[model samples]
Target chain A: MLVARGVTVAIKGKTLLQDVDLSLSPGQVLAIVGPNGAGKSTLLKAMTGERKTTGGEIELDGRALWHWTTAALASRRAVLAQSTEVVFPFLVSEIVTLGIRRNLTAAEQYRLVQRALVAVDMSTMSDRVYGTLSGGEKQRVQLGRVLAQVWSHGCTYLMLDEPTSSLDLSHQLLILRLAREHALSGGGVLMILHDLNLASMAADEIVALKDGNRIASGAPVDVMTDDLIAALYGVRVQVRGVPDGPFLLPQTARLPG
Target chain B: MSAGGVAMPAGTGAASARRGGLMLAAGAVLLVAAIVAALAIGPIFIAPADILAILADAAHGIRPTEGIAMRDAVVVLDIRLPRTILTALVGATLAVAGAVLQGVFRNPLADPGLVGVSTGAAFAAVLWIVFGGMVGAFLPQAVLAFALPISAFLGSLISTVLLYSLATREGRTSVAMLLFAGIALGALAAAGTGLVIFVASDQQLREFTFWTLGSTGGASWFKIGIALPFFAALFVGSFWLARGLDALAIGEAEAFHLGVDTQWLKRLAIVLVAAGVGAAVAVAGVIGFVGLVVPHLLRLSAGPMHDRLLIGCALAGGALLLLSDIVARTVAVPAEVPIGVVTAIIGAPYFLYLVHRNRAALGG
Candidate 1:
């Protein structure tokens, strides 16, 4: 489990996230949704120890995040950043192999890399040059890398920052479904998502933020009402209950309705 | 699987390693051939068979007999042989340093020569050359012999630390800052070198200028011994750094997430670059482009895996330098042009071509 309490992040006296408190228990998928500059990514980075917090306590499995060695922390949590720029012509398999810890035997690492690539539907491109891949394919490869990192580490946390931002619809669903499966298999996933309807469908819980402050946090259906989302994004929106979950549509007026 | 076409894992596990091993083997053969050529083709040329015999005699403590002329033995053993070995060593050091620096800075254009590191070492070496008589008055003979190389190493070490600290912030190295700082440092070090030149006596000035032009013309057994330790450090460090550097090629943050200690890797790479460039500059002045071009050519052929790239750099760096040194020695005949000039003549155009090819990455 990952927990953040009283987390505040400020850079040059500008607060990016203020007193943000959240907990991600094992076997749960938590999606954070907010407009641009709302600090969703900042909060996630802080929790993952990528960004330092000004005032906060972040803990993983009862141990403080700051106190854990980087290697130890890495073993417990895998991060799939929004974009990882690789300028060199590394084979996709080589990139995925970076996430495999040294403790694993060569055969074990090979198997894990193959499995992770398969998880993201990139097993076929394992020998292809990573630089030549399309943006969405690159994101999937990074997903494969992270999946490989935590594949054997039980009760680990996966922190993803806008993992679906560049992905197409089906690929986006594929990623979230993989994250959902990760949670189902005794992991905790904290993902920053832009698509509210997808968030409603995939996330077991939702945390909505506006101007660096949490506006609502609960089960998706309880927190993703039309009025809440409209105020959160400063736009008029409609929420319709589908058979599975709530669907959100932005209400644009032809004239000043 | 839907539209992207699911296929079997192409499986890069053992094949790349096997290919890298083959490339390394080829590189080693090429280096040996270059060394033999370097030994055989100098002024007052000796046969390759006689050169091999001379080398075997030197290794086995046997006196040269029957077939070798005294003058030929002196020229081959005392002059060309040591010169070739030193050239090979310096070349390998600079190339490996260049490859490692490029990995550390995450830029293909980063080289010890281009970044003022060689200039810094040269500056200190020139200072010692000018003032050694005065300083040598007090020091022991053995210490006096080593003073110049030690000063050169110190100079390179200091500059590397300063350059790295200046460009790094919050555990992140700014590539633009590093490049600009390198320019500023190069200019400053060059100005200092000029100041040393202004105060130099006529003979001191000549020596200083010749060193600046760069050569293995001064190669001696002592010079070769002085450079060996730094070369060893660089070779071993490059091997140790292969995995971390491979991880870093993606990005520092990503490498850290992959369980690499990025800070330690940066510090280690900087130290190794300093030692390698410093020692090479001490022994052979400043031979350019072996560092810049060799690794890049190898990268194009062998891919960017540093485990292979570094080894490839060692082999190819030696061969390229031997070739350049050959041109430097033979192209000008008895005048014996500086190796630095030869490298620059070859390097500058190739560097421009690289810049043109990577124009978009450089924001040109």
Candidate 2:
């Protein structure tokens, strides 16, 4: 279990997230849905111990997050944040290998990395310099990195903040599909997505945020009501349900300035 | 230049033990070549074999043959030896420190000395030189020479702490912020050093100017003794950090979730950078661009894994500075060029060449 209670985060006197409580359970994929700047990323960070909680506490597997060493936490949980900011060029294989550093040995580690690369279908680009790759290519390599992390340390909790932002349509589906399969394998995934339709198709549960609060959360079909999205985004939205998932449509009904 | 078998998912053989062995052998060869080249080009032109004999005798303080001449002995041991050793020490230290700082900030262009570490050292050394002259009657020259490096070290330590505190935001350092803070602190330190030089008497001004120009004209065996341990520590520490740095290259939040103590790694890096860059400038003064140029060049040639980059940076830096020192001492025959000038003259063009050739890579 991954849980955060009454977590508050303020950056430079601007309170981005306030008193958010969340839990990500085993074999469940939680899609954090919200408009831009609604603290979806901040909420994920607070839960994962990336952002310091000003008020309450966080726990993973019934122990306080503070209790686990950072390395231990890494093996237990995995994350794929936004774009990396590395000054030096790095190879894709080198980047993926870092994900397996703490848990696996040389032989097993390489095998796991190769497997992770294959999962993302990026096995052929492993030796390419990460900087030399295109944005989508780099994103897949990063996914491969985290995939290696989870594969080596089985059943790890996973969080991804906008993992699909730089990806193309095919790779995006490939990545989200992989995350869902990972959940099926007993690993948990919490993803913050701006694409509500993508979330509807991919996530088992949807948690919606507005102005730093967990305003809505439940099964996708239940939480993605037209009333809720219109209220959340302040833009009229039409919610459609399909056999596979819910589809959120940007409504033509603009209610004046 | 060998992109090493364009196959992706490079099998075990790609980063295998063989590649590591090859890099190590290349490093060793380059180092030996640097040593031989540096020892060979002085006014007397001693052969590599004779240079080894000179080394063996110098170990026991034995005199060389009379045919080798008193002038040559003084030239090799007192002049060239000190300069060469000091250059190697300072170069290796700066490159390792640069590697750590760049990784800590996750900025490829972040250089340790670029952020005011060296100027801080320079500032402290200036303060000592300007004020300590008043106590010449009380303090022995040996003690004064020894104290300068300490003051420089303290200066580096203070500036590093300040830079770290200011650059850090939400427990992570942004490279742009760190770079700005470094420039600000560097300017401030430079102004402080300038103030001291501006107010001092004419002769004192010349001394301050020469010191900042960076040289090893006054290096002794004792200073080498003091430098070796820090170099070794930094060398070992750099290898340990290579993995952490590799993790950090993919964003701190991801690295943190991967189990790296991003905060602790950053703090440890700041301290290491302070000690390494401080001790370096203390011994040999400010040698610019060796840190910046060496790593970029290594990355360009060897590919950019910290495993390769760190070792390549250290060995290449050691060789580069040693070669520059040789040029400094021999280029003008009897009159010596400041080692700093040699590095600057060589490094600036090399930097320009990299920028010119890799304009797209540097993105202007």
Candidate 3:
């Protein structure tokens, strides 16, 4: 389980996130959704221990996040940042292999990397140079890297910040499905998502942020109402319930230029 | 589906390890050959066999053979051998420094010389040379004699610390900021060096000029002794830094997430670069291009893994420097061109080609 209580993040004297509280348990997929600049990414960074919170604390597996050594924390959790910016021409295998903890033997590392790549459907591109890969392919490769990081065993925490932004429609669904599978298999996932429909479909619970405040948090079916969506985004949306789940459609017609 | 459109091969750590092993072995062989060649060449050309025999005798503490001329022994032992050894040390040190800096800066174009470390060291060396007599008035002779290299090391350390602090903000180093800061620092150090030049006497001017142009002509067992410890420090530091740098090459944020202690890595890299390049500059003047050129060339052939790249840089940098020093000595015969001139002449075109190749990345 991962818990972030009253987390606040400030940069250059400007508060990006304030008093935001969230938690995730084993087998739960919690999606953070909001408009642009809603502190979604900042909140994720705080939870992952990437940013030092201005106030409050984050805990993982019932222990304070800071109490764990970085290496020990890495084996239990993984983070996928927004972009995979590599300056050199590293091979895909090399990039994916970076996630393995140093304790693993050579054979163990090779097997885990292969399994992670297979999970992301990037097995065939393992030998390619990462610099030459397309945007969607790079995203999947990054997913493979993070997956390998926490693949050692049970109840890992996977934190992703807009991981599917660069991905195409199918790849986006594939990545979210992988995250869902991880959660279903007794791991916890904290993801920041822009696609409301995907978030509704995949997340067990949704935390909505607006201007660095948690506007709502509940089951997606309860909190993703048309009125709540409109208030959060300032854009009118039509909520339609289908057999699969609730589907959201923007109802506002564009004004003539 | 099929987005990569490239051939995928099996993941074999064995194969990659084997290739890296071969590359390192080949580099070691080339370095030894270059050492032998460097020892054998000069105005008074000793045979390669004689050079090896002289080295073996020295190793065994045996006197020179009965048939060997006194001039041959003196030239090989007192003069050329020390220069070759010193050149190798400086070459290897600067090369590793260059490789590590390029990694830390996340730019292939980042060299110790370009980033003001060498220029800063040269400024300090000039200060010591011009003011040593005045300072010697108060200090003991032994400390005074040793102060030149120590001051140079201090100068390089100060400049690198300045560059790193200026460029890094909020745990991120802006590449453009780093390059601009390097240029600014280089200019400031150059201006200081100019001030020293203005106050220098004719003899001081000549000595300072040699420091600027760079040479191994003053190489002696004593200078080697002064530089060897720094070389060892950097060599071990660079190898240890290899994995952290490899992780950093992806990105700082990503590296930290992967459990790398990024701040420690940056501090260690900057210090090692300062110490290695500082000692090299102190001993051999401002030998340029070996750091910039050797690592880039090896990356093209050896892949970009820092473990192999760092080791390869040590060997290739040493070999390239020996080759460059040989050319420096032989180019104008007894007139002897400055080594800095030789390295730049060879390294400039490659630099231009690299710039052209990376033009898109440079956002030009």
Candidate 1 vs candidate 2: the TM-score winner is: 1
lDDT of 3 by residue, B43-160 (tens): 8889888877777788899998777776888888899889999999899998899999888888887778877888898888788888867867898877766787778888998998
> What does candidate 1's lDDT look like per residue over B287-354, in tens digits?
77778898888876777889889989999999889998899889978888888898898888988898
Best by lDDT: 1
As for candidate 2, its clashing pairs are: A87-B108, A88-B108
Q: Candidate 3 deviates by what RMSD?
A: 4.1
Q: Give RMSD to native, each candidate.
A: 4.0, 4.3, 4.1
**Runs with alpha carbons beyond 4 Å of true place in candidate 3:** A152-155, A249-257, B1-19, B66-70, B132-146, B202-206, B360-363
What tens digits encode model 1's per-residue C-alpha lDDT throughout A160-206?
Answer: 98898888988898998898898888889999998888899999999
lDDT per residue for candidate 2 within A1-257, as digits (tens), equals 99888888888788888888888898999999888888888888877777777777889999998898887787788888877755566667777877775635566766787888898878887767677888888878888888888877763688888989988899889989998898988888999888888888899899898888889889998998878888788877677788987786665456537
* Error of model 1, residue A201, in angstroms: 1.7
| lDDT for predicted candidate 1 compared with the true structure | 0.83
- Candidate ranking under DockQ, highest first, comes to 3, 1, 2
Question: Candidate 2, residues B27-76: lDDT per residue as tens digits?
Answer: 66887788777767777787777777777778987888655666666777
Q: Order the candidates by TM-score, highest first.
A: 1, 3, 2
User: What DockQ results do all the predictions give, each relative to the true complex?
Assistant: 0.46, 0.46, 0.47
- Tell the DockQ for candidate 3: 0.47
Model 3 residue A33 lDDT?
Answer: 96
Stretches > 4 Å off in candidate 1: A152-155, A251-257, B1-15, B131-146, B165-177, B202-206
Q: Fnat per model, in the order given?
A: 0.47, 0.63, 0.48
